[model samples]
Target: MKTLVVYYSLEGNTKEAAEKIASSIGSDIMELVPVKDIPKKGLMKFIHGGSGATMGKGTELQPYTKDASSYDAIVIGTPVWAGKPCTALNQFLSDLSSTEKVIGAFAFAGGSADKCLSFLREKYPSIKYTVSLADRNSKKLAPENGSKLSAFIEELKSELISN
Candidate 1:
């Protein structure tokens, strides 16, 4: 069994959390980039995410550094912007064809109740969901939370292995 961590990090907060999650369970990582990358400023990127756009900037999709289908489970990570998953994951979601695999959605953000949770649900209706929280500015996560993420990943693996 294999795992993939495919995520978009505007201010690197999500990436930090992703690294923690991946550390708990060995998994290869992929970073999603639009043709034009967003600035590292979290506030401005947050504005762009809520703009109600189908896709953003040149939209040059980075080639799948790793095949999304090869993994037994995939964890999609992004920061909550105006309470929605960044557009990058939403863009990537449409590319995948359902294969009855373990898909999990996790979002990192400092504020907003249920931030990005609804957007992830709207975009990937089929995925099983779990979320994590972190400070947007500091971008540091507690180690124990990675254990929470690890538990989630383990549960998915067990279910997949059982079948």
Candidate 2:
């Protein structure tokens, strides 16, 4: 079955995990980038945060040519910022509505994993399956993250195939 790994990576933490997930499942990858770059640090970051501040309402930002409809399953990932998925991911996800898409998610956070998972679960109630992967820092991937994420993806794949 076709799968898409869509994610928003800040400081590459999320990207590292996303890459592993893609390779494990052979899923196409899509990196979610803001049309406007974010400040790596400083007061500007505190003020605008990320995508929430710059993205236009319903902004598509970096568009992709793939037919999302072709994917039998979709996995999403994001870095947690201040106990939530980065603002950009939140804005971007707001565009999706109920369809028959099979969905899964993994989140990377500096420390607290609960907060990001709570937010995403509430936001995307339609998601069929979900997972959360976090590390203590935003700069690096969690140890053994690739193995853990791949295991979950494999489970999802098995279920899809059985059905």
Candidate 3:
């Protein structure tokens, strides 16, 4: 089955996890980029990003070349921002046509991914698998987490095959 992994990352944590998930599942990957860039550091980033996520705002993104409809499944990865997915990913999900496709989600955070995962579940009822990682920063995942990612990929494969 063909699967795709799409994500938006600001601190590189989400990007690290997305890449690993894609590699494990042998899926195509897409990174969402916003037309307007968010500041990477300082209080402004925290204020803007947190407010945007808390308010469920959507940002304009650079045109994505890949059509999500072409994939049988899509795994979305994100880092928790003010307890929800970032603005870029929020826009992507809002604009996505996920009809007849299996959805999966993974979230990373310094403390918790509960809010992010919950938000995704509500938004996409098709999500069949989910993973949450805590305290992951802008670095590659550890070997143990890599094993867990491999297991997640296996579960996705199993679910798709059964369906």
RMSD for all candidates, in order, please: 3.7, 3.6, 2.6
How does each model score on TM-score?
Answer: 0.74, 0.76, 0.88
**For candidate 1, lDDT tens digit of each residue in 34-118?**
7666666657755566663324222346787888877777778877655566677766766767534536767776764254666
| lDDT value for model 2 | 0.67
lDDT-sorted candidate list, best first: 3, 2, 1
> In model 3, which regions exceed 4 Å deviation?
99-102, 137-144
Q: What shift in Å separates residue 105 of candidate 1 from its native position after superposition?
A: 1.4
Name the best candidate (by TM-score).
3
Kindly list the per-residue Cα lDDT of model 2 for residues 26-88, writing each as its tens digit.
789888777775687787764555435333233345665455666776778877665666765
Model 2, position 60: C-alpha lDDT score? 42
* RMSD (Cα, Å) of model 3: 2.6
Q: In candidate 3, what are the lDDT values of residues 12-103, reduced to their tens digit?
A: 87898888878866789999999986899898988988999999999999999689888888888887889988898888878887634747
Stretch of 10 with least lDDT, candidate 2: 50-59
